[model samples]
Target: MATESTMTEARPEGKKLRANVKPAPYRIPQAPPMGWSPTGSKRREWVSRGMVGTIMFLQAVLTLRLRNSPSVGEVHTLTDYRSTPFIQGNESIYPTIVDALGITGARFFSLLCMLACTAMVYSWSRRLFNERVGLAAAFAFAVIAPTLVVGALATVDAFGLALLALATWLTIESRQGPAWPVFLAAPVAALAVVVNYSALYYLPVVTLLALLVSVRVVAPVMAAARTAPLVLVTIGMAAFTASVTSNQKMPESEDIGTLAEGTFHWLGLITGLALAGAGFYVKRARMGEVPRGYDEEPPGIGWRIMLGVILCLPPILAPVFLTLTPSVAPLWKPPLAYSALFTATMAGVGLVRIVGRHFRFPQWGIMAAVALLSIGMAQSSYEYTLWPNASRLAEVLATQVQPTGKYLASDPETINYYLKDKTKPTQWTPTSAGDPTKALKKMTFDLVVLERPFLSKADEALEAELRDSGTYRILNTVPFRLGWTRGTHEIWIANDVPVK
Candidate 1:
């Protein structure tokens, strides 16, 4: 009877264990099921990404179209300084890249650089701050009128600016760790200097600062390694520039004076400063020690004062130098001053962030300030669009002058490009400040074109003498009209001149 009871108890326990067991070929442990809901922040981020992509695509398209337009005119004879090498058919070293690249190639390359720079800036800014700050900086660069105009043409300014933006991005990125990438970027920076000699001045100042930052972040050994490529590339570029400029004659010192005179654009400088100041304030208030919602950092008073002082330096120095030494002063004109202000402001804000504990700012204020500054800059560019009017004058000359007659142009560069291969004139007439009448009298020319603005009182007297000499008669007095401004261009013909 005891054995029977034991069996009954054991059977009940076995049945209970069997009930808990499952029959399967293989058993797999499952991870905790993930929640399916999407957060608001994630959705907003996706939307912002889509918007940025769309905007960039549109900007690229607009820039491409602007570059392709023939109506914009050839950029070859934009300045007299660019005329000599251009007309001489010097292929190895062009005075200005606009002559070398041609319209299409220049435009394409410029657009490419602009887009790349914009993207790099956006990426760097975003990494440092929030998406809003990144967008603001990128948009500010993209919409800047001078940047757009320069980018549309075949000049080196746009390319230089692009390289500058790239260098800044690389330098900032390198601050995070080892700066191997800066070595790769050095060649590009060097190329920028080759393209524009002014970049030599600008790059060194920024590069030194960058190196200091890099050394502080990374070890000294690593910084040196990163800087080695820059040193090599810079040396190579300097050699190349020297070789190209060695054989070329220096432009007349007076011509340099004229260039300096034309470069003064005060409105542009002011706008640049204001924009920079606003950017600095916004960046500091948002990203500095004080959290945006909380008033912890108190607006970085020390940083603001320092930046304000720094921003004023360029403007002050520019005038003093211009007054004391006009030649050197104009060389570092409004553009450089404006660039300095922007750079200093950004640097100040960055310094504030390094010292601050938290980062946040009033988003609306930043956007408003950027938008206002961009609009003002765009308007300023519009106002000064046709300052020299060389291209427009060239177009007029092309239409007015006949193909068979010998024509003498005061601005030989413009005529050479517009009348290339046409049997118009013996190209040796001096239309600059020098006396060209002896040369003019020696050559029997059918027509003579003179840009009145370039003529001094003495030059005008000579022109009048030519007109009154009875050997040549006035054919057309082409008024050099520029958007409500009436300028003058005089055309004359010899009574019995031979066709070329």
Candidate 2:
């Protein structure tokens, strides 16, 4: 009986010992993290880090360049210089956000937003259908030329596009589950508006999308209550920042015009909203109605229609909007317009890839379109930069004049940059034109440079009056182009004028 009791106890102990013993090295190793393995409080870190690095590097390469070298020319230079004062004043955030981050900080942030957009697109594709569809959606975004080119510029276009893309991604992702990130998207979007006023146009669209996504996932009442405060806060913050920065009052009259003008003013917003709605509706309606007996499941007619609408909306609406509103019209002008077109093209390509199984058509078509558009734009830009009339005028002012001369020139910025330490020069402005001329009479300038191209027909009479005063003598007619036409730039010497 004693031996039996002892053996039973020892057997239990031995079993415990075997359980404690480590398995051989050949035993299956702990599975590395899979797509959706970890539960709450766990998330992938490396992927996010890698994505951030990629976004920053791509933006830097596209925008960074040596100072003093010509880059895209006047507009870019002016923007850079103008922003310098604001950046310096707000050194804490602006420096790191703008200069230190490189020339294309806005573009970098935009690209990051695009990557998030691609992620949402992939999710939408996968949830609606298969891995093949998801891959196709991603591929479509990769080759979009408009997006790539705009992404390449160091401008506000990328910033606005990025914010818009982020808003879209957050809305779409929220449909999957409780998306706290969607709420956070409001502040980021508000910041985007502060960066570029054009982004203000997207506010309504983003709010609608967020509400739509939240209603689909959570209850409508709850979602509305949750999102309402966020929307209000976003608008308030945006308005406050804009007012402080520009020292301008906000335009409160939503009577910004009738449907015709509103439609034209916010065309991109309308198109984006339509496409997003179409996409969501199609995805919801055609959840499992794939045709059988085929090797692959083709998207339903509704899906195809939605994709088509998304692809066509931008180009169709762009002209209508541009034509209707002349006040904030530059949004549709070249270079700037190119950015929107590029973003629309990218989104369209992504849609086509999702709807059509064949990718080559949209892929190659988008490439060709972008290439042709870029070439034409570049040629036009080059022509404007090398405007012969302006160049000739600058040459005369820089070379023909004697040193120690006091001169007045219209649009003196370009001349000042080129003719450092050559002459005492003052810029002619509407307010200063009279004062400057009087001063020139008093001290007697060696030469006064005035380009006919820079002045209107009325200003030509002013030029003749200055010559007729007998205080100044017309020294030479310097051919130049400061505006559009090739015209004479008068060089006047103050030899005949009495010195004050």
Candidate 3:
């Protein structure tokens, strides 16, 4: 009680103070959590740029190698270039190459087209998201299996996809200010279909993308105004492409599941990560939170989702659609391919968030990235370089048979290419020609070749008729098919020809 005298309580002794007082409980100094901050680091910037340069360089080298390599099945088809419109473009450019270098060597054009596609992938992703996303998107395009094959495969699809990318980039650029792109875009869509009939399938996607993009940037009336021309132009192109290829025989299609799986199943880690990135964005939106620490602002998301959906659906649905055999048969055949541009960009986003944002376990993110690249490298070697080297097969044929009677095989274009000097273009007919059994009976074909595990019920029927009719004898059977394609190839010669 006496101590209640207003003397400040005497300070406790050191031991007592220690007993009562808590040490600044094993704490880190109060500071911002340390993480990667490359924003101002020139070294980091240069290192990233270096990586991108290396990737593009490697891709260029690979495509160039394929350009000079052996011809695969459909590669020879590009040699015709007759069905290809834009006579000025195709006739002017490709003939010189075909004359100087054989069809395989002429694949340089496809390489150029693919390079344009890859460059566009980077630019579109950068504009849509950020530079990191752009780098990642380009990397995905480089390593993904389809791209590995398509990049150098001598087909018109690559060229069409390149134009699609350019048109898309222009449309995206319009978000900033210019309205002239839509006018250019409308004509571009038509031009794409004209050049590669396969491009017709993408018209709907272009229209929808334009409408969504326009809505995001301007008022509804202006958006409609911008989109109307695109819609009209796309419809006209679609009609024109159908009319042009109406007489064309369609390729046999796989089951619905097969078509869908062909694309997404092979996609592996990149696709899963892309989908997860999309889901994450949706989740964060639902929770009313913004992503933290994003280095660059992303563009409006609605159009991007529209883009991804459109790119994915055609690969899955085209099989079913082609089976219906619409009155206006599109010359473009199955697996009408599209760039998974949006998917690739999303994959880039997923990898970035995991490695940079989730510092607790960036190792896992790194591992996924490694796995994607590894799969791509493995697939690159898993050649689609069609079986039965056409040149070797031709050599075999020259020994057993006379030059230039009607030649029938699964890939007419391939046979035609190897036999160009020996045979006339009209002398070759595709195995898919209807009721070819009647022609076999007429001995209309001097030499017939059939691939076993037949491409269609019709082919199987034709083979049966050939065996039962006894009009032809087996000349040689070569084992040339491998890797997902089945073939114990059969060669038939009219029985009258004396065996050498």
Ranking by TM-score: 3, 1, 2
Q: Model 2, 1-500: lDDT tens per residue?
A: 57976666555353364444565768787775444322222233444435434533443343222112122322232323443222112223333454545544544554554455455554454443444444434433432333444444444555555655565566556666675767777777676665554555455555765675566567778788657855885678666655555743322222323433533432343234335535654554332323333224444655455444543454454444334222211112322232232234334333444344445456644564354334433433333323223444556566655465556655454455455456433432331256554654474555566666544554565576576677777776866432244566677767654332
Rate residue 299 of model 1 by lDDT: 30
TM-score of 1: 0.64
Give the alpha carbon lDDT tens digit for every residue of 1-500 in model 3.
44754334545655455344566767787675545443446785576567777767877776555322344323434456345322212333344555566555546666666677676777766665556667777787766665656665655556666677677766766766567887688887776765555566667766766676677679889988887877898878767766655665544445566545555545646677777666555443211122345343444456456555654454445555434322111122212335354466667767666665435557977797778777765555454434445555677776654565677777666666666677766777788666688788988888888877676788888888888999998898876654446457788888976777
The best-first sequence of candidates by lDDT reads 3, 1, 2
Span of ten consecutive residues with least summed lDDT in model 1: 325-334
Considering lDDT, which of the candidate structures 2 and 3 is the better prediction for this target?
3
> What's the distance in Å from true for residue 315, model 2?
7.9
| Model 2 RMSD vs true structure | 11.2
lDDT of each: 0.51, 0.46, 0.61
Off by over 4 Å in 3: 1-49, 60-102, 207-228, 245-252, 283-339, 358-360, 377-387, 401-412, 426-450, 453-476, 484-486, 491-500
Could you give candidate 1's per-residue lDDT for residues 1-500 as a string of tens digits?
A: 56976666555354364444567788887763434322237776786677566646655654544322222123332343443431222233333455566656767676676666666656665554445545555555455444454455554555666776676677657756766657657876776665555455445444554565466566778677777776676677667766766666543233445434433343233335344544566555554333244433333555444434443344334433333221211122323322532343343233333333333434534454455355535443443334334555566556645666556666554456555655433442545536667655764655677666644565676687686677777666656443245567776767674323
The residue-level lDDT of candidate 2 at 403 comes to 60
